[model samples]
Target: MLRRGNEGKKPLKEKIILHYDILFKSHGDDSFDTPTFWEEFFLLKAHPDYIEKKFESFVAKDLIQMKDRLNFLFEKCLEYIQCDQPVRVINALQTMSCLFRGIHSVEVGDHGFDKINLLVGFDMAETSMQVLLRCLTAGLTNDHYNTTIKAVILQLLLVIATGTDNISQNTFVEYLMTNEELYDTLLELLTDPVARSRLGNDTVLLLALMVNYRKYEGVNPFVMRLSVLDDELALSCLGSVISSAFASFNKQFVSKQEESKSSGLFSTITNMVGSMFIGDSDEQKQMIKSNEAILLALYEAIHLNRNFISVLTHSHTDATLVGTPPHTPGGTDDESVPSQPATPTPESFVDASTTRNVLSTFLQYTSVVMQDTKLKRNISSTKLCFIILTCITEDQFANSFIHDENMSFQVCIHKMPMRHRKVKAIVEKPGAPLACWLLDLTVEFIVSHMMKDLPFSQHMRCLGIIHRLMCHEKKCQIRLSYNWRELWTALINLIKFILSNESAIFGRWKKGIFALFTLVINIFNMFITFGDTFLPTPTSYDELYYEIIRLHQVFHSLENFVLRHNANPEYKDVSSRLASSMVNVLAIVRHFNPKIEQYMKDNNMASLTEEEVLEIVKSNYDDLTLKLQHSLDHFERYSERPKETHFFTELVRSISEQYRKTMVFDNIDLQDFMHF
Candidate 1:
């Protein structure tokens, strides 16, 4: 026999080894009976040449023991995050490059997730992120790697951590801050739109991690306290912060979504950047020494910096800053669609408009709690404690992140009518008003995202939201002069549908019923409004018409939401009266035009043929649904089922019956009250 000198393998491409190693480690200690998506994912498709040498002998089924495989696969990532390895900076890029081309499903899969969290979690290893920082700075400057290569590498790291959350709070970011190279490398990615485009959920999570991670100057952990005057750096940093925030939504949170209970991260970025606009107000009538040109450049930079624009425009930002960022031109483009838009845009921008539209639509089902019933019952029955708690907690959480507490508190009050005037309440003082008001807003957001498909969908959540808000703050309603009873009643009404997954109170589709139903009802917790006024009995035909109205209301609501949240006061017109009017008109329309609906169905118009309708619905749904699509709801502690919402039930039942029976006046008789 020949000498056995050739059997041993030579030094392999670092990435190839990394790919195999990560896959091997991620495979875990489990077994697979059949072929797994693992090999077809990381190695075989990624480095087919290397597969023959390393994994060729391993059966595809053998790849199932994910922990072992993944441990080997992501060993590099684990090492890099902990700042371990021969050349962590180089290895980090190599690991990322390999991950970019390979399937990211490993990290997203059940077993893969556990491994990554364990590896990348706080202090998984001893190495520092400083190496990664150096690697990035040096990598970008090298002629060998272009922007695309950098993108691929960066995206790869992102792929590994897609839905795994709180990744920002880890120490990896802290280590990187001490290392200028990596931080600068990230800055480049944030500043360059072309490069940032490649960053998706993974990038978002990484940025979140970076923002929350401690920055090291000498010995202490650092914060991203940005200055308004530092436009060049601020612009890109702002973009990165926004990108990171929005990216948090980019993951496929099919099961339970991981939401930050504490608005800590969201508040951090918003308030820090918000300091720039500290004095640009009508009431205060103050402006920093910074001149006009600087403002103009800031506007252009934010606009050109797509990531920043999308982030700052998200619903999480303070409502005052929601509109166009101070000096931007022509306001937000996404805020222009009216309801039933027929055409919808892609979900590249999860801006403020998207969030507002979602919330506004959900509020339609709200009923007046009746000055009679608010807080009338016990702790559980009243659901007051829960509502108050959510608000107080949200305010506390958001405030903790605000560097200038007074400014944030001012904004919290500004959302109210003459909020600055300040009134006394349970929590005490002007700042307390914001906490109360914020609870209202938060509950409003929850109700806005209700759905009929999930049974007592919106109804359950609405009650839950309200209850949470009322938990710690009892006198919150004192802040609003309007009839809070009706509003609270409406919330209970929405919650009813969420609790019971009955037939869509609106209607069911004739074709692709399941899929369409999922898209319309299950996929989205959209609101439903019926009749111009009064109630309709539940009937099949009525259900269909009601569904149409629901679609319409949702559309208008979305359009308004976008405008309202975008800092455009125009969208905030959906007052209780306005909502009531729309409901009345919808009822009358259903009462009179039930026949047209049948005719449209005969002519195929019943299917909502207009692409714009789908667009608006999808866009609005995407905006809010993204939050739900993640399992954020799971984190919320539901206290108890809300009191019966006769108002919502009566109204929904009224539409169902009237439309089914081809009767109208009961739902909307225009003789006494003019038709809307």
Candidate 2:
């Protein structure tokens, strides 16, 4: 019995010491003849039966004896990797990666992996990183050993990155930061096609861990270096880095099933991208100052990936109508010809659904950036906003984005105030400021696009966005003082064009008319509520009066159109609502008119009668009259359609009752006007 127990214990104890000696006793000068020995040893260590039975006991007993062995092994592996024998080098790397994985898998309860502190405490983490960096550089430069060696190198790098203690992670980060060549080499490798395909996500995670370590340690060497790079190189580097990160995020997190691993991967990528702009120093601010192209590239990458996610999640089908000729009024299908199946064209990345998602994602990212107070003050941030303005204002994106009421255009509008505060602070600077430019661009887009020929829904959307801007207190305050004249002129022209076009007034464009009315009301309310800021100078009173007169004529034309259409059941509610809007317009004009007349009287033109005033405004008054007459004539042809003549009876009676109560209209019969 004693001899059997000794025999059984002898081999187990010998095997443990043999593994420890191979790991620790190896040195850089050792011969490469033992490559198979190390490979076989790692293969034995990876076996399930050995792990389940002997691995824990072996580690608990031999881990202390193997003190600093990982460091020596890392050095020996590096030496072998640099040797001329390809087989020895590959085997050395595979053995190194498997050993690291095995060490990382040994867990002690609540203490994390047991052997990670060996590398970190001995200050060997940097050496491991150097080896991994060398492998990455090699994989990138030599295409012959790309896939096999590169993948194993990445696995080793990730094991060190994610499976180590925080001190070890920081030590690795320090190596990456202090070696600029290594940093740039890693980025170059990331952009390389072969390296990216084999090791993109792992590289991204490593980069993220470095950034996060810097954050925790409060030493931002990488970001500091990024700040001082030449503009072109900096932009190129950022573009490549962010594009690769976005690709990884799309593949692992957005396109795949949402597992915990993928979620962690996405979080790391996000942290990496965000770390670039997170610092508060002037250098960090300068990193984003003039790099509009870089920021735009990042934004577009996220936008594209977001679109990919939407496509993957949504169910999309395409139906094509092919090989079918138009039929005559009484034609039937021919019996002799066989019909062919309509083949559906494959959906592409730029399909309508994807395009819509691209727009949505663009807006969402724009909103996020705008709301980030850290970035809000950066010039590049403003430029990013300018890019978004340019996109949404363009005919293609705008026309498509606005027609979908389900879109978040309104949500973006609501977030403009955050941007408004930032832009307001810098509005008066010498160069073209973003806030002023965006406001001017918005006006230009509205005037150029919201025409009579456009669809009513499109027009309504354009007007709705404008209404939101007009109602935004900050935008109104700034715009009312800076670009109010240009904005007012463009809006007046739009209103005149809409009122003059009979189709706009009476066709299926009631929503558009209502939107236009709401925009005008908001503008007028801004002028009224902010009287101290918006009041015209005494010298400008005549121009203001002329504007009020033009508005009065517009309101009168609108009132007449509503009265004519009030008898049509289709237009009954719309006409009534518009009539009420007209009453509000009249009241606004009435309140401002007396004040303007008093100014005119106090200035010089007290003797001008109503006829004189009409003569002075003859050109605009004639224009208004001609438009109203044309609309009335157009409606006269449609007058024979079924009408509820009593639609306006209550409306007219209310007006007469108010007039009788306020004024001495002697011998007036309200019933006469109520009959319509």
TM-score of each candidate?
0.29, 0.36
Q: Which portions of model 2 show Cα errors greater than 4 Å?
A: 1-36, 39-62, 68-76, 84-91, 98-117, 120-136, 164-170, 197-201, 216-218, 231-676
TM-score of 2: 0.36
> Candidate 2 on 1-676: residue-level lDDT in tens?
4554565554444453456544444244343237665554432322222332333454543545554555556666666667654455554555555455455545533453235455333465556566656665664455454344455555555444444444233234355556556556556555554445444444554444444343433656544443344434333433434433322222222222223224676644644454322224353343333223333433332232222222211212111111122212111122112233344334212233322123333333333233333343442354344433433333232333333224322112112222112222112323221233334544544454444454443334444444443333332232232445566666666666777876745465655565555455445444433433433343232344356565676766666767887898976876676565444346645555555467577768755655455444432322221111111101011120133123222222222222222221122122322221
Best by TM-score: 2
Candidate 2 RMSD computed on C-alpha atoms after optimal superposition onto the true structure? 27.2
**Which tens-of-lDDT digit does each residue in 162-198 have in candidate 1?**
3222323223333445654554455555554433433
RMSD of each: 25.8, 27.2
Position 433, candidate 1: lDDT: 26
Off by over 4 Å in 1: 1-133, 141-146, 156-178, 200-202, 210-483, 490-676
- In candidate 2, the residue pairs with backbone N, CA or C atoms under 3 Å apart (3 or more residues apart, or in different chains) clash, namely none
